[model samples]
Target: MLKIRNLSASIDGKMILKGINLDVNAGEVHAIMGPNGSGKSTLAAVLTGRNLYEITEGQVTYLGKDLLTMAPEDRARAGIFLGFQYPIEIPGVSMANFMRTAVNEIRKFKGQQPMNASDFMKLIREKIALVEIDTKLINRSVNEGFSGGEKKKNEIFQMAMLEPMLSILDETDSGLDIDALKIVANGVNMLKRPDNASIVITHYQRLLDYIVPDFVHILYDGRIVKSAGKELAVELEAKGYDWIKNHDGDE
Candidate 1:
């Protein structure tokens, strides 16, 4: 569903990603693991077209079209969902109204009629249940005064509502307790289909236990240094990222 080749990006004239290459096919989950400052989040930002990072080289094709050329909103409308590492708080807007507007906008982009109030309410209820999110929180402003776990679950809730084809979850497991982590992973697993894919970027291997990936890639120093199967995550857990740095002769 997504193809990236020799993709490099920079921000404020300092290059961050230096030649990233990967392929995410339908029905697959790819995990990106690395230490801090390794360009894991940079890859996600580049793919989602965050505007700050300029693509220095290479190409990214999503579903056979030039993904890097599309606007951020266009990417979202084209079924690209990015779960932020730090979800921002919108203090004045209710979650219901915010999501309703977003859903309708995507539908309009797809040339479909807007969902009616009754159907929208039903959909909202279903998604809230799917992610095990608190109903009371939905009536409040987006991420306003939410606990860390609550904010991450809210991100998954939005993901469920949008049903993006390529979901790029950047550190979705951050700050989540075991129970909250399980709930978030369950929601992501349940949302998986034969025609969609996920790129999970995380630092710890514990997240991989909950959301087992088809491929585990070690991203180091703005490039993917090693790619392996699910067992690679287990290896990384046992050996730690220092092993990766040493193996790559960084010292």
Candidate 2:
């Protein structure tokens, strides 16, 4: 569903992603494991066209369309959803209103009429149930005063509402207890389909245990140095990143 070829990016004239080549097929989950400052987040920002990063070289194709050329909203409208590590708070915007706007906007982009209030509400109710999110939270301002776990659940709620073709989860496992992590992972798993995919960027293999990846990639120093299967993640957890660093001749 997505193809990235020799992608390199920089921010404020400082290089971050050196060269990244990844292909994600529909229905597959790809985990990117890396140490801090290894550019995992930079890859997400570049894919979403977040504006801070400049693509120094290479191309990204999404469903045969030029993904890098599209604006952030366009990317979202085109079935790309990003679950941020730290979800932003919109103090005055109710979650319901925010999500309604997003859903209707994507619908309009697809040349469909905006859903009636009744239909929209029904749709949201179903999605909220799917994510096991509290309906009361939807009536409150987006992410406002939410606990860390609540914020992460809110992100998954948005994902369930949008039903994106490819979801980029940037450290979705960060700052959560085991139970909260399970809830979030279950929400993601429930959303998976044969035509949908996920790119899970995380630092630890603990999250991988809950959301087993089809492919596990080790990203180091702005590039992906090794690609393996689920067992690789367990090995990494046991051996730590130094093994990969040394294997890649970085130490």
Candidate 3:
């Protein structure tokens, strides 16, 4: 569904990603495990057209379209969803209003008429049930005064509503108890389908236990140094990153 070739990015002229090449087919989950500042978040930023990062080189193709050339809104409309590491708080804007706007925007982009109040409400109700979010919270401001877990759940709630084909989860496991983690993971798993894919960027392997990936990639020094199956994640957890660094040096 997505192909990234020789993808390099920089911020303020300092290069961060060095020739990243990755491909995600439909119905697959790819996990990117790396230490802090290994360009994991940068990759997400570049893919989502965050505007802060400059694409020094490379091409990103999504669903046969030039992804990097598309605007942020276009990317979202094209079924690219980034579950942010730090969800922002939007005060004075009810979650229902915010989500309805997003849904309508995508619909407009696809040349469809805006959904009526009744139909939109029905869709929101079904999605809220999928994410197990309270209907009352949807009536409140987006992410305003929400607990950390609640904010993360709200992100998934939006994802469920959007039904993106390619979901890039950047540190979705950060700052959550086991119960919250399970809830979030269950939501992600339930949404997976044969025509969709996910890219999970995380620092720990614990999250992988719930959402097992088809491929595990280890990134270091702004590049992917090793790629393996799920067992590699357990090994990294056992031996730590230094082991991989030393092995890479020997190679």
lDDT of each model, Cα atoms only? 0.94, 0.93, 0.92
What tens digits encode model 2's per-residue C-alpha lDDT throughout 1-251? 99999999998999899889999999999999999999999999899889999899999999999999999999999999999999999999999999999999999999999989999899888888866778999999999999999999889989999989999999999998999899999999999999999999999999998999999998998889988899989999999999877885321
User: In model 1, which range of ten residues has the least summed lDDT?
Assistant: 242-251
- Tens-digit lDDT track of model 3 for 1-251: 99999899999999999989899999999999998988999999999999999898999999999999999999999899999999999899999999999999989988999999999999999888876778899999999888899889889989999989999999999998898899899999999999999999999999999999999998887788888899989999999988877766211
In model 3, residue pairs whose N, Cα or C atoms come closer than 3 Å (at least 3 residues apart or on different chains), thus clashing, are none
Model 3 off-target regions past 4 Å? 249-251
- Residue 104 local lDDT, model 3: 93
What shift in Å separates residue 113 of candidate 1 from its native position after superposition?
Answer: 0.1
TM-score of each: 0.98, 0.97, 0.96
Clashing pairs in model 1, backbone N/Cα/C closer than 3 A: none
Candidates 1 and 3 compared by TM-score, better number: 1
- Model 1 collision count: 0
On lDDT, the candidate that comes out on top is 1
Arrange candidates by lDDT, highest first: which order? 1, 2, 3
**What's the best-to-worst order under TM-score?**
1, 2, 3
